[model samples]
Target: MAKHYALASYADGGDWRETEHLYVPRRDTRLRLQSLMALGYTASEVAAATGLSPSHVCNLRTDVVHTTVHVFTADAVASAFRDRWDKLATGPQANRQRSKARRLGYLLPLEWEPGDVDTDDTTEMFLSDPSSPETTENPEVLDYVAIAEAIAGRRVTLTRAELSHAIVTLQDMGVGVHETAERLHTYTRLVNRYRARARQDAA
Candidate 1:
């Protein structure tokens, strides 16, 4: 039977010793580690990528070590596996598995690899073709920030702490708390939108 591990997260990070997520051995774990190794990743490399110790990775290859690890650690390992599987997989089974993993948020890395590609001819065609945006400009839409900021005057930058202070200071004058919060939220959102657009245009 496949071993099950329970990994739980906490708001504040703590020592692993404080948690139940640690090695407990099983056959399925060994097979899983071995399979990943067969795909050309060294235990050390995989360990680094997955936030695991090399010894943990190595033991999983030979020992049946299993455990309820932290969700963050499991996520790191899942991400590493997804990238390697997508990059080196040789069959439909691997492709299907990779697709499922991707849907679960284990996305492949964006880097281009010219040497070895396990994907089909369509991938090759895509890589060979010079990449260009399908359309230059986005469909004309109302610029919410532009309209808001034009009426509100040019945006003034403030640190988060400064913004918080401003909100509290305004409330000290007996302004309605809910209205103040709403106005501050709208102001910050519009300012951020304009700043983001400026950066995009500069880029």
Candidate 2:
């Protein structure tokens, strides 16, 4: 006598169905929740976005749980949070943030005497990097990159301009140039990977 095992059935009866599952671990969800909270989200808001109760969200944020489940709930919540945050961090809102910072003197304007060299040449020299991707200048792309960073436990929420300023500020504060460039390169890779994933998902 011979025995058989159960297998997935295909509608066309030609092959087994191609099955795919999404597993969002408990740790991932907790980290994402904390990242959103640090970005000023309340437990209720996170709960609403995650389809969980406020208390549940709070518990997940504060307590340590180790489990991985196959579902889309956590991923969906993270996606929603990223979309909202990206909107707040880009376009007119981002410009408004810069304006407020300038008004407060946190950022300085470029002032020079009449004898100074052409500003266009200087600006191009300082701002443009031929090796860098053009997408970094787009806030939406930055937001997607930030989502990947947050998942990795580094909750960064800065636009490209802000990040550039931060790197310069760090260098001025005595941070090594090589160190800053290395970190920036890591982030660039993350952004590129996220953009690729977005295109694949859309297709």
Candidate 3:
């Protein structure tokens, strides 16, 4: 008997029916899930990329996410593996994160005076790499606590509704609210102000 046996049935007059089952590798997909989880991708993100439902992806946990028969199509799994591989192998994030200090290189040129005679200087210099600017601790969320503290210190005032509305706007822009608020502590407030100013300028 062959190791790769497929079921078949034969009828009269050379009529026959057969079921072919392709060999699928017996690899654990949960390990892949764990790796992606470590990279901070949510199950929804994985499902979106692999065409799986969010619940299906959520159930991919080998233990808490589930250890039962949560099988996905081999094609979907393979596509996910390839996508991860490509992301790891290419693009801007291929380089490691730069330090906060190094990212603020734009401030260096501001120190030069009017009589600086370096027009012929061949040495390459950059104020700061605009591609990777210095982040003041939080880049995504405006620091509300800090803003509140500052406002208190400076006697600035805005209604609670206004503040909450601004925060809600951030959440609508793919930010996870509270967490991004913390991560973007200072900038969130600045962003709202900047956006409002831009709208005013446009108007």
Candidate 4:
């Protein structure tokens, strides 16, 4: 269910505008955190993004509100969520997983060995062939703030947060939360998710 409100939102000079439909904090922070994870946030990142601790996020998974949710301050959660809210701009990761789930795949190149990519070093190739007559770049990424914003987009958003929280209503379904990224260069899946999602959403 949606939590909505009609408030006399004021303008700079005191002009009032009515707005409706707001999000409510159900006793379900854990479910929301799970959704945020699927959206590509690491546990620590989600905590940073949502302004809660990893333990608190863990508790949300269990709906252990008596121990976790109540201790979270409103300002902290709001700040964390807002930081991630702007991350909402990010659509998906750069590289997508192969359909029919490959048993194995080529490792990314770190350096050129006689023009052949050497994936031994495990360095990521964040570069994309933008002018390859295939992909488009975000206009904001050309500058510093946009790049930072793009990084933040890998977090979560209010919409995702709401969807995450809604899992509690899913007949008490379990939302498994895990973090697989520890090496910075391992964001291939995330980058692909962003790229694919961006492409589809744009279309």
Looking at model 2, residue 52 earns an lDDT score of 78
Decide which is better by TM-score, 2 or 3: 2
Best by TM-score: 2
lDDT of 4 by residue, 118-159 (tens): 221111122233222223444333444332332333332222
Model 2 C-alpha lDDT per residue in residues 1-203, reported as the tens digit of each score: 33322222211222332334445356545654554454345667667776778897777655665575334555445454443432222233444544553453331112212233223322232234422563246544445555445333353666654455445444455655445434443223323433444445459
Clashes of each: 4, 0, 11, 18
Q: Which ten residues in a row have the lowest lDDT in candidate 1?
A: 8-17
From the highest lDDT down, the ranking of the candidates is 2, 1, 3, 4
lDDT, candidates in the order shown = 0.42, 0.44, 0.37, 0.33
lDDT of 1: 0.42
Per-candidate RMSD vs. true structure?
A: 19.6, 19.1, 21.3, 18.6
Give residue 46's error in model 2 in angstroms: 1.4
TM-score, per-candidate, Cα-based: 0.29, 0.35, 0.28, 0.29
Write candidate 1's Cα lDDT for 1-203 as tens digits.
44444332221222232334344324323433454554435667778777789897776555423534344554445445544532234343544544554453332322234433334322242233222232122324434444344223333343333333344444455555445434443233223333444445459
Return the number of clashes found in candidate 2.
0
Model 4 spans with C-alpha error above 4 angstroms = 1-28, 49-51, 64-68, 71-74, 86-203
Candidate number achieving the greatest lDDT relative to the actual structure: 2
After superposition, candidate 3 runs with Cα above 4 Å error: 1-27, 63-72, 86-203
